[model samples]
Target: MTDEHAPATPATPAVPATPAELVRRFADRLADLGLTEAQAATRAGMSIAYLRRVLDLGCDFDRPALLRLAAVLGLEYQELVSGRPEERLHAAAPDADSAPLVGPPLLGELTVPECWTRLGPGGLGRLARTGPDGPVVRPVGYLVHDRTILYRTNPDGALAPDANREAAFEVDRTDPKLHEGWSVLMTGALEYVTDLALLAELPQPPAHGRWVRLTPGTVTGRTIRTASAR
Candidate 1:
């Protein structure tokens, strides 16, 4: 039996780039066809969770899982097995750091409710808190209740707890061709829900153990809605 987490015969990392780079390299091609992990999984005749786990496990991905992922990702199986950068098969790598769908200087004020409607579990948000370490961003699941947004993030997510005590969470989806999409940002003060009982009151699965509250103020957002390249 082989472990998916460990390399078959490890020496070092594959890409000078980060795992994020690898994930990004494939995201666009996936999106071009309006494909997501869900769609890819279906095409590959596998489950979404299984595909997700394979990508998440990357270097440690097993033979069968790796094979399935490569097929679904429009990659050749031998390339995945080789783990060689030159052999890298994905072609959608970004020339620069920019979301795929954004083209021009599209900007405006959007509301928190408007943003929340589009933003969900997959997007990451940065937190500004009282701590001296400064802001940090991480992916988080989100929920809304009575116009208030709640996020469950790690304790270390806070930057300067008392001083800023707020978070700026943003999510956007782009389409370089469709020429349009939207960006949503929510700025508000956050309070730690340290109380075990009160924490339970937050709307989430029982598996989520803790989180914080964001009472939004001066909410803002922006939407491209549509754009034309020609």
Candidate 2:
């Protein structure tokens, strides 16, 4: 007979709603493992600064570093990405009745037009530049205007590039469960947009102090998909 008075099993926590929440979960897991951030970073083969930035500032999500860190923390990659404990157990032991294993991922290059299509209407992307300390990469919201990239920032902010300075921008999306994604990169010169006439025609009014444009010298992209999906 089932004991109605028996203690109930705890419900599994819901998946993190955002990247910042995922980082917080990582912190909790780190504490559970009784390891400091420095120790975890060392075991994960990454710099403490980079780990701190990811954990503390919610900076760019570096996949390779995260995969290594997940392994170091004794968790599966999918579990780390999805915050689902069941995924870890499932990865550890597959059911014999389950479907056959998926093949390796296939990568293919994207043409210039295809790259633009992938970047349609723009959204959030990483802007890379050389700063006083070293290479700097930060996320910024952008829009594609007349085949050029436009983003706004404070005139004195770190994202503010000098006239015609060289920089790189990248945007990507992925599905951890499906293991498929695409990334588009733009290498170009960044300059201030001073054309009042052109600025007046923007779909949305400038929200920041200054508008900057990335005039691409080259555009490239790549897509990754599981062989089974092909």
TM-score of 2: 0.53
TM-score of each prediction: 0.42, 0.53
Q: Give the candidate number with the greatest lDDT.
A: 2
lDDT measured at residue 99 in model 1 versus the true structure, 0 to 100: 27
Per residue, candidate 2 scores C-alpha lDDT tens digits across 17-133 of: 257766776887665443567767887887998886655543245667877877776665655666644343334433422433377767878888888766755467899988778
> Which residue segments of model 2 deviate by more than 4 Å?
1-101, 203-208, 228-230
In terms of TM-score, the best-performing candidate is 2
Per-model CA lDDT versus the true structure: 0.50, 0.68
Q: In model 2, which residue pairs have backbone atoms overlapping below 3 Å?
A: none
Q: Per-residue lDDT for 146-179 in model 1, tens only?
A: 5555666555434323444566666565544334
Candidate 1 global CA lDDT score: 0.50
